[model samples]
Target: MIRLEGITKSFAGKEGAVAALDGIDLTIARGEIFGIIGSSGAGKSTLVRLINLLERPDGGEVFVGGERVTDARGQRLRALRRSIGMVFQHFNLLSARTVAGNVAYPLELTGAYGRNEIAVRVAALLDRVGLSEHARKYPRQLSGGQKQRVGIARALACEPAVLLCDEATSALDPQTTGAVLDLLRQINRDLGVTVALITHEMDVIRRACDRVAVLDRGRVVEEGPVTRVFLHPRHAATLRLVREAEPDGGSLDAAAASDLGGRAVRLTFTGPAAHKPILGRIARENLVDYAILAGRVGHIRETPYAQFIVSLSGRDVAGAIAGLRASGVDVELQGVAPVPEIEERACHVV
Candidate 1:
């Protein structure tokens, strides 16, 4: 339930104005986890701030929950902001306050409750975030994940219809990251809150987002369903985002660069096609030899899927290729032999 039309924001640089966001057109549906992914200076953070009018756009419109937010001022803006909650990379909690106290702070700001009312709401929030046991704990005593849980609880205190997470898991370890992501997913499902998250981590987007917008150089290069974007990324930046999502313990640039002498096609299998080992069966029945240079089998939405780049060898090259294609399998001839030159060319083009 968010729409941004021709939204542009700029800041004065030493030489001239630098466009942080340039004519951005975005629409996020209600109760959907929408993601904005980009590297540093991609205007990801600025775009998120524009949603809440934390950074008003210089040109174009900002609409949140069907209300215009670009030119909202004073009481109107303050009232509109109450329906949106934001979390940051650092768990921006009041270190001086206890876990329960921090969650109650938002309610206090709105002047909406007495002490007992605040306590009841805070207790419920602590329970919702699984921090009831640590209600009295101070920020310094909690781990990064717990601190984030506190931040999330605080954000939920206002019962905002939208939650804007700005690199919410960037500071935590992988285990903690998964926990926080799970918590956010639950928050979305249970509370029906629309979540908009901006992060450099593709894994975060992959796990949390239903749809995503790939931002590069302050422009949206691509935006669509998470599974579509992950399986068939259209842009270099989009592919980069997918690579970072899994990574296989290293950068995708190097992994993709590894020479696969034959044509390397990124075979994306989905739906019923993904569940079966069709490729393996074809190789076995046809008596063909194939070398799997680099590949992975993973799930998107718990559906079994895989991608592999294999070097095929056999006498009936065209026939064998046709056989796989005829069986409703997706295939592409990447290239042949002379691996290094082809890989170099691909890298440069991307």
Candidate 2:
């Protein structure tokens, strides 16, 4: 639903020209949640603003729904902006307006709907966001989550095909963050709205996004399906982000695996295979004694996955690996993985 090509933007810094984005190319499919993640200075916010032409790029093009919006002007620009909904991190609500009024503000600006029509639309939006009871309340009376809900409702007032979320959950607590992400997922599933999310948190992408693009130093260092990225991150930037999201920096010291004193292998298993007793059964069949040197259990979307650094003790070590591989387990024959950062979301130990 959204595409950016060879997009480059730079700003005048005290020292010189600072490149915020350079040669960025990306495509966000319809009805999917796409996340762009990077550190504080990685230009995540600037890239997002470019989508709505809030900040025009110095080079390349921005397209929405296959229409080139890079050069849109006046009424065309206004219409384009209205079609793309934006939810800010700080819940930029109109302080004086009531929840109902805040949601109706966008519709009021368009002047395309009658009073009754706008009223009905506002009511429905509030109901959809579960804020119907707080319609009469002002932004000051609402919690952070409630205010964000109002912002979401306001953004969706026009039934946009795309929703741009700029650090949408960064301001909220973890519990509230989960709740808000659930709401976004529901919105995407029910409305078929393509969502473009920007964040520095890898957890956010793991929890909600279908695909992800890892931004670093003003360039895309990594991009692909969320499951693939989480399971097997390749780029240094992507690995760093994954490690930062882990407990105790997310990896065992090489000493831990090497000290086990046998053929060490990193075993990766996912989905229903993770739940099966395949590892134990294969070990027994091959007459191997395996010790779990280190491991983690987590979910990729809804699918459960487990990665383990295991030390094998037996004559038929290769046989054990072969058996596991034949059963669809990913086997890597490295004695000591320096930084194995396979991550998980849910707490279910598979």
Candidate 3:
């Protein structure tokens, strides 16, 4: 487990001190895959570095497994680092080293094992990462994904209790990214190693993170379970990230709104509500004619969710909205239509 309390870090900038992290307070539970997401220059990378003391915080404390390691030095710092493993965006493998040799490098540096022990440990690690067949091969001979597998194997050489992944899948193609994500998930489940990954990709967070923190301009603007944050992004930064992740969906057009003759509303449904026949029931009971402007149904982790941009024409628009809300559907009135006013709610969904 890792905890950062009131963490703040800054560096010299052309305009003076620039804060890479400001007043950050985060707790990553043991064995959980926690994600830190932000755009370029959003301080995601700097925050991750602070965790391993690669960039010590200008203020506040860093705690791992309940130990305050903010000021640890020498052997203490080295020992703390050995319990944490890091993988980079670029597969940081020694090009001259064979796959086995890359994995053995860390163990050799520790000087805690003899030749036979290091060889056995390296072989087991190669096998664990499914790179046993490539053990004799060099980095240049492997594909991008394979090279990353080598990087992962090397990181695990120390058998660290925590894994820090810095944009681990950012460079690969979509298919390869999925493969690497799957491998990380398997590692977490099998090894019970706590994972803290930083990326600009919302898809990566959706697929791998149990909880997430959205960073913007050196501040944590939002943080929550992936399902809650993804399905109903509260911050503008979070919404922008979500839109970038799924840009295929069209927004409700003004012409479409004018033709519907009533109210345009966005509905969000999650879990069992996503599969229920609530829409049909609402239409039958309220006699409302509904037009689907745009929508999507997908999974947030394992939970099924559906979001719809609907145009509704009916005598009881308020009743319909209330009905949907009563059935656990999140209903937001699109500004394009003139509808009865209701109490404002979180997510702008009444």
RMSD versus native structure for model 2 = 2.3
- Candidate 3, superposed: residue stretches over 4 Å from native: 248-251, 336-350
Q: Which candidate is the best by TM-score?
A: 2
- Against the reference, the lDDT scores of all candidates come to 0.80, 0.89, 0.86
- The TM-score of candidate 1 is 0.88
**Candidate 3 clashing pairs, residues 3+ apart or interchain:** none
Q: Please provide, for model 3 over 108-163, each residue's C-alpha lDDT reduced to its tens digit, 9 standing for 90 to 100.
A: 99989999999999998888888899999999999999988889988888999999
Model 1 clash pairs are 263-334, 263-335, 264-334
Model 2 misplacement above 4 A:
335-337, 342-350
Error of 1 at 27 (Å): 0.6
Better of 2 and 3 by lDDT: 2
TM-score winner between candidates 1 and 2? 2
Lowest-lDDT window of 10 residues in candidate 3? 341-350
- The number of clashing residue pairs in model 1 is 3
Error of 1 at 218 (Å): 0.5
**lDDT by residue (tens digit), candidate 2, 126-206:** 999999999999999999999999999999999999999999999999999989999999999999989999999998999
- Candidate rank order under TM-score: 2, 3, 1
